[model samples]
Target: MPAIRPQTLNDVFQQAANQARQKLPELTHNQQVARLYRKSLKVLSSWAIDRDIFNDEATKIRARFDQARGCKPEKAIRLLREAEDEIFAYTHPDPYCNPVMPGGSKFMRNPPLPMDVCFPDGNYPADAPKYEINPDWSKATPENGKAATGYVLVDFGKKNME
Candidate 1:
């Protein structure tokens, strides 16, 4: 095994100075702003369905960015973050519209089958048991009760525990 050498305070300072001397790549204020603007536009384009509407919205977004072109670094960053938040809140890529299933959205490749073809014997059951809510609370076992009480009754209609 090689012998380990102890480093002094001078050596540590020298190493830190060397690291400080080496410049790291960093984006300028304008460059960062422009990049953010372009990214927001791309996101908008992906969410938009109509070409004309997208163009109109993109133009408006560009104009907003341009208005804050001369703002200080801190102000610019704040403005950009606010813009991002507003855009995200206003536009949702996944809207609760028609589903992507066979009978819903146009994107589905498989055609939906007719009810008769899907269920040949008809979906309704010949003898289905009718459901009824039991009013008796004392019959409940301690293991199944919400509380440690011997019997706890939960009434859905009353929306309370007894």
Candidate 2:
């Protein structure tokens, strides 16, 4: 429900990935992304159930990928495909069930952060790769930046891309 639950997604795959460890424990970065994508789809589709509004899974948008059976990036993204129609697809006519899409749900939940550090949490590998950002953009809004503009400004979150 609600496009998909990341916590549920993570738990299911984490366990599955562990089981596959003997078969393929360490998947490449790309593979991990792909595996997450596949498992996410499978779990999402399986739970779709018999809904009234859905147009059927055939004509929906989806992210499709292959599971190379590894960790990190186990499931490599192949082609994005929709496995099912929105359970609340008829929201146009009926107002319920609109929350099945990402950002579609109105309910909110609080997320716990691992470390409240301004330091770069960095990428998955801790030191995956680094890219340069325009120094000017890193500055706080003009109001805040007017206070100071130096010191390798670290934003705990303008949100990390990956």
Candidate 3:
């Protein structure tokens, strides 16, 4: 049997990008330039780890944008396209993500159990207890297999849980 791979944040991002591309409207020259600038800065951030160094590189990027600020529309479009290509080429293979955020090592490590379990017939029994919070396992019975008390529940999404 083929192994089922869990979807990663990269997969999520790729899907989003695909959708965006499919539905993308034409951008004005200024919007294109702004997008390229933001993308370039993000690429630079991933490449330069040190704050001092990143600041220096970011300043250089700002200067480059400043230099092109008054270009004619035709030239600006060309420059924006080139800048986009450059940013894409320099993008990090594995960009840094906060440990708790998407694409990070600890992301979704411990997902929450379902709010309620369904039997093979796809419905809860009439006697099934409704729970607003988590079951207090301390008061659970082995034979009855039920909790006698409730605890506050904290639920993050399967993709967001840690």
Candidate 4:
């Protein structure tokens, strides 16, 4: 009868890492381009505040992508990156302009009161006392006071220690 050996932590981790690496598919240039095209189309569909306008823009984007279909690997990659950047910049759904009233993409209006002065009463109740940290070390409790020291060295090469 063969003796069964227990798997070490490193062996188990290595097996899991190898499996994860093997599961990832190596996509070809055409596949990558198709994926990007589909993803871009989906993003544009979501960004389309108005359906008709979005459809027109999407059609234009599709035509541009189609024009670069037969381009070389380097050129295709560059074109795809440029297209992604353009799409992101043009259809940015969340253009965070301050004052944030309906559609102001420029300067922010000043608040009626300063942030600190606005909340004069403070967030907590009136009865709650403000906490202040004492500089004296004698008053502080040790963070690991209850932890066992014996097992500390045994955790050498453990998952979290790494």
RMSD of every candidate to native, in Å, equals 21.3, 22.7, 15.6, 16.7
Please, what are the lDDT tens digits per residue for candidate 2 over residues 7-101? 77789999988988876377665565455445444444545555532235422323122223332422223222221233233223322233421
In angstroms, the error of model 1 at 19 is 15
The reply for model 4, stretches above 4 Å from the true place, is: 1-15, 84-162
Q: Which pairs of residues clash in candidate 3, taking residues 3 or more apart in a chain or in different chains?
A: none
lDDT of each: 0.63, 0.39, 0.69, 0.58
Residue-level lDDT of model 1, residues 89-158, one tens digit each, is 7655543233432123442345444555646886734453233222233334433354444655544333
Q: Model 4 lDDT vs. the true structure?
A: 0.58
Name the top TM-score candidate: 3
Badly placed stretches (over 4 Å) of model 3 are 1-22, 109-162
Descending-lDDT candidate ranking: 3, 1, 4, 2
Clashing pairs in 1: none
Better of 1 and 3 by lDDT: 3
TM-score rank order: 3, 4, 1, 2
Worst 10 residues of 3 by lDDT: 153-162
TM for candidate 1 is 0.38
Window of ten residues with lowest summed lDDT in model 4: 153-162
